[model samples]
Target: MDNLLSSYSPDFPVASDGTQTFDRDALQERIARVRTALTTRRNPHGAVAILADNSPDWLAVDLATAQLGLTLVPLPLFFTPAQWVHVLAQSGATALFCAQPQQGAALGFSAMTDYGGGLLLCEAPARGGPLPLPGARKITFTSGTTSVPKGVCLTSEQQWEVAHALHRGVSGLGIKRHLCLLPFAVLLENIAGAYTALLSGATMICPPLAETGLQGASGFDPQVCLAAIERYQAQSIILLPQMLQALVAATKPGDARLACLRFVAVGGARTPPRLIELARMHGLPVFEGYGLSECSSVVALNLPGAERIGSVGRVLPHRSVRIAGDGEIEVRGNLGHYLGEAPAPDAWLATGDLGHIDADGFLYIEGRKKDILITGFGRNVSPEWPETALLGTGAVAQAVVVGDGMPFLSALIVPATAAIDAAQIAAAVGLANRDLPDYAQIRRWILVAPFTPANGHATANGRPRRQLIQQHYAQQIASLYDTTEHIA
Candidate 1:
């Protein structure tokens, strides 16, 4: 980590958001200051939990713990009250540093010394809990695909490797100003977004998500995003597929507001090629990539010169990818430790995702291994395969394709805009169906309201909770089949 910070000049700007600034030197000193304060009041080598919005103090706490050789557990801002309790008790976190002033009472902890960004340390009762990964330096919880979120333990080595590789990969692009669009707690942004920018001597803008025009995970205001780009003149930003889709929908052709963007990496979920093309048509330099938390966020990315539109781009130099016999993507060389029961030593991690590397080494992800829908016609399909095509048709904001053991595929479609009617959406679905084979096209669909975490229809990161969504819309889904049968 020292080597990473030292690579760029100390005077280089590490981060800022108009008002506050942290040069390389200042950031290193702040980390040292935070470490000193924590050590005076607490013991060394204990787990320290931090719950806060993105700020310089968040970075300071992260670096302080890493420097002190203490475990850092970051709790996401989106977690429910019950979900947050589960993590705190599950991870065995004894101390907490919260940036929000009232977080202390909410989490039941008294105040400690203030960090640079007005962050206060909070005390918590230490209940003995098993360490899923015994020697893990960091624990990041999943966004609760089920009712409980899984904690993934990772060492500093794995994180630094991803960050260094990211810096090396995008060095040639001359990325100077990077606006962090996602939560700093998100591993994707922590490594690829913040670490990569600092390592490459770029200025990282760490502002509140609301300031950047984002509300929770599902809400977005494109004009706010555009204004941020114009004001900060950020050369690069990271986004999910849904965010990119929103931007393209709101933007007009030849819009020069986004002209400052050099590289826009979209991942979190599968990105449709039409979405990428639509972004390009509006002069947004969007590139598609794929990754998950277990692999330490970034696995493959489409760089500036060597980009594949449909594929998720070439694998990083630090990692190796091979397809398993079951058609799952097996990743080696960069696999991190899972919080519970470590895998066999040096065993290849089988990513539940189904994908294959192209002849040129670019990866094309099909969909989740568990999500493969086998139609009654004896044909197998990846729901994401048709879903991507459907999303590309610009008719739906969200889609879930289901046809397991059924005659043909059917979907629950959320109209892209409130103004768009079922007829317009039907036409769009028809356009998507043209590109697919007979068995893979959408045979039936029902327009519905958007899926959100508040409604128990999706995860915090925007992944559809298949079981909950299926159950919540059980009646409508059954009607699509013209049978009163449940999707058992």
Candidate 2:
């Protein structure tokens, strides 16, 4: 990590958070300050948790922890207080840095010294137990389908390899300025955005989430985001598929506002090919990629000259991917282990995602392995296939297909805009159904409110929590399969 940071020139601008910019020398000075503070107030567990917003100080603390050999646990701002409690308890975090000291105090932490950057260092009593992570440099909690998020332990070497690979992957685009759209706590932005930008000698423009037009977990304002891009002249940025959709909808054909973007890597969910097409039509340089937290963020990505629509593109240099016998995508290379579990003896990490690598080496994700639905007629269908088809239609904002053992599939649809009526959504569904087989078509669907982290239907990164959605709309879903009739 030190070597990677030292490779760049001292005067290169590394980080900015709207209010302050950190060139390499300034960044190093901050890191040194953080390191000194940690050294003086070291906890018994040697673990520190950060619950602040995106800022240059966040990166400074992260680098300082790496140098001090302390495990860094990033607390997501979108997570509920209950979820935060669960993470602090499980990860054995003995120190915390957050803007709200009272909140930290409520979470078993007492106010300690200040961290000098809108964060207060707090101390917690170490629990009496054998620590789960012996060598983990960072423990990132993933908001899965359940209420309690899972922590994935990563070594410094594993993270650096991914960062270096990302730098190599997008270096050709000459992206010297990157705007961070997601939270710094997200592993994708932490490694693939911050670390990669530093490695590539690029400036990381990390304005607050509100400034970047993000609200809580799933809310976004595309116009505000575009304004930030224009203000920063961001040459590159990362986004979720839904964010891409909003931006594409907000922009017109040959929109000059996004002219500064040379690369826009979209992931965190399956991107419907039609959204990519729509983005291209608007002169947005959008590319789809695939990854999970277990593989340290990115596994494969589509690049400029080697573009393949619908596919997530080839695997990164640091990782190898293969489809399991049951079609689960398994990745090998420096994979992180889940906290409290023994490290896998094997090199391969079984990503719950189901995908296939084609003859040309482009990787295509179908859906989740457990999400595949087996109909009453014994036909197996991956929900993402029809969901993608549904999203491809510009009218449908979000689609969740359910019918694990029913006669036909039904969906919970969210319209692209409140103005789009049922008739328009029905027309969109019919158009999407034309390309699907009879068995895979959405036979019945009901329009519902948008899924978001606050609503408990979506993860922080905007991926739908299937189990929660099913439970929340159980009666609505039941009504869809009540009859033998098909909406189509």
Candidate 3:
């Protein structure tokens, strides 16, 4: 508690909506009330599922769960009814707290009473018993790229460690306002954005993602997002790679809407170096970084005055990193808890990612080891490298690079706008291809409709589900060799 609360006073703003603002004093009091309510109304150690949006009420529940030392399960709004059932059952969550009672009804939940601030506490029959996590205070579900999402158990102690480290990591940057772009359920924003803002004495803006031009998991209006930043005068924000690209495209030369931004941290995917450079050219203050759920949230970051163009910056001082002989990044210290059953506690976790640390200690990620594509020529290519390059062109909104058993590479692209012509896309792909080697270049290409989470083509956090991508475009991928390019 001290690590997160020590920097703020009674009156400092903690979180806000368009109509209301909650300060530190209000947060503390509300946390206490919720803690008392939970203790009086629910089982001591049983888990509670939070099915809500970004609002002051959600933070109160989050802090209350930590304070009461109870288990919390955050259910993503983007998840389907069946996925929600699985998460709630896996976590043994009997209490469902949500902003809209209708949402609960859609998931077979009936209202018990209002939990206050437009939240309802409903009861559900448990499917599985309480999980056997001894010290776990929260269970965050993975993005479930190709399958059902798994739970990741975590202790408040581990979460605070990351938050405190992040506060210190970006020290002296004068970051006073932080706008939460991703859903609060996403661990990246949960731990790094909200928690670190409190620890750093910064105000947090938790407006509904829709208000900022985010529609579900697929639609984004970058102009609306920029307006929110301007309206709030936000100093810093957390962004995914795709979001950064759109924001960069939305900004014009000498655009005053971005003048108040002091920092923009991009992650949640491998960022192309060209995108970072483009952002700088357009005067958007963006930096790239990396992390996974297992390592809490943020393990490495690129901050102002200490940034590398293609690196995820230095490993955070709180954790240590060493590259494996096979080129995987190995992490040591406080990797946090796991779900279902955790792997045996060990000194280091091999991150399934393949990367190397530079002489300057900056970590440069190539791609996921499991997702590497093997061409017919026996050349190994990580799709992210080329996919990132394609996205950086500013002509395409989405790209999926795959050529797994083929002689050469092929890509499925979604134009950023309807105004973008085939010639522009062709030119963009040609430009992006210049940075790649022969075997990894797109030999045949197809342009398809946008891939989005709602369409099962992307995960909740904006990552492409490769199998799903391949399945949806199976005919196009198959015809690429024969027809060249159709509506593809």
Candidate 4:
């Protein structure tokens, strides 16, 4: 009956099987043990690299690192072996932890510890207990889908501030349950899904990642996601725009399977209004949110109490936001300093995103500032707007618009189904053109193969890696305008 932050009961139960709950006392003990081990080795300043799937042990390690006052770097689960090496070296992680030693050994780290089957057991140290160093100096490697990935350093205080802001933002809501769909390695999910849920005394239900309605090659099966929702009776969940679209496609009209659900937050990219409408019609309360990694995951979210259809919702209570003269979103209050050095007083984090706020205070995200295309005739265009239009046609699975430094805009599209012919794609393009101006319209397009996470064409959160996609299909994109008839 104790409040979430008040008790700090290390013995509190985390999971249950209808009969009994799994206590977290052992996890706290493991943290004590790890602290002892690190102190005995005189390596408190060293960084610990954790490469493991989501499980009880992962939480244990995270909590343990926090208790020990040691730096923790969570390695992405989907990274290639080469990427793993790059992150390990770039992060300067001295110790590596994994569920599988063989895989850890392959990564070629100096020291490796195998905590088998996602369970770690260690004895508490007598002398070296917890440290008062505030919290972790966490470093998360960027998903270098387009360019080289950089290490984003965040302090524990900063992370905790973000969690607190989210807690304050949603505090009025009653006790809720959160179903985590994205991988824990993703900062958005880690902070918002896990930390915010913890702050709210909410139960965090993590179904298998593959069954969570994610739409990429590495995404979850929509059917499995629905079944998990029914089994757990999840009240709230998170999804990317693509996953929301997929769920809308998979479910029948007026399906009551998700009747228990209250809120389904969709982000990581723009959510089409049509998809939101479909999800609402299918009995899912989908709310679109807007955020980026630099802002500690969430700056604005549409709450159930103050819902809006197309906007990402009002700015959270602790945050201050404004649009710059150049159309960039500038955010200020309740912000944290970057890891390495203190931020300046006027440190207005320029969210490379461009959007406008309406008189009613709802945020309508236009598109990425860098992704905005301007034609040779001097017309501004947001590729995402047109891409969303193309996707709503149902035949196009994905669309990327290219027009920067070009005479006119062109598009590269992927079909929704393997059997979908070129004519169908063209028809979708035609529909998209109807809503666009001549300068912003796609004059030429090519049917490209499916975008996949393995190739780095899409982010782990399912947003298209526009720069990477442009690089991957550079030749094809150029070929689109190679024909004399298509050239302006």
Higher-TM-score candidate of 2 and 4: 2
CA shift of 360, model 4, Å: 2.7
- Against the true structure, whose TM-score is highest? 2
Q: Write model 2 residue lDDT over 183-206, tens digit each, in one string.
A: 999999998899998888889999
Lowest lDDT 10-residue stretch of candidate 3: 123-132
How displaced is residue 391 in candidate 4, in Å? 2.5
For candidate 4, write residues 52-125 as lDDT tens digits.
Answer: 66555565566666656677778777777777777766666666667665665576543433333243222112
Candidate 1: tens digits of C-alpha lDDT, residues 314-359: 9988788899888999888757666666744356888898999888
| TM-score per candidate | 0.95, 0.96, 0.95, 0.86
Ranking by TM-score: 2, 3, 1, 4
Where does the lowest 10-residue lDDT sum fall in candidate 4? 123-132
Candidate 2 clashing pairs, residues 3+ apart or interchain: none
Cα error, residue 401 of model 1, in Å, equals: 1.0
Give each model's clash number. 1, 0, 1, 1
Among the numbered candidates, top lDDT falls to 2
User: Where does model 2 exceed 4 Å of error?
Assistant: 7-11, 42-45, 126-132, 483-488
- Candidate 2's C-alpha lDDT? 0.86
Candidate 3 — which pairs collide? 447-488
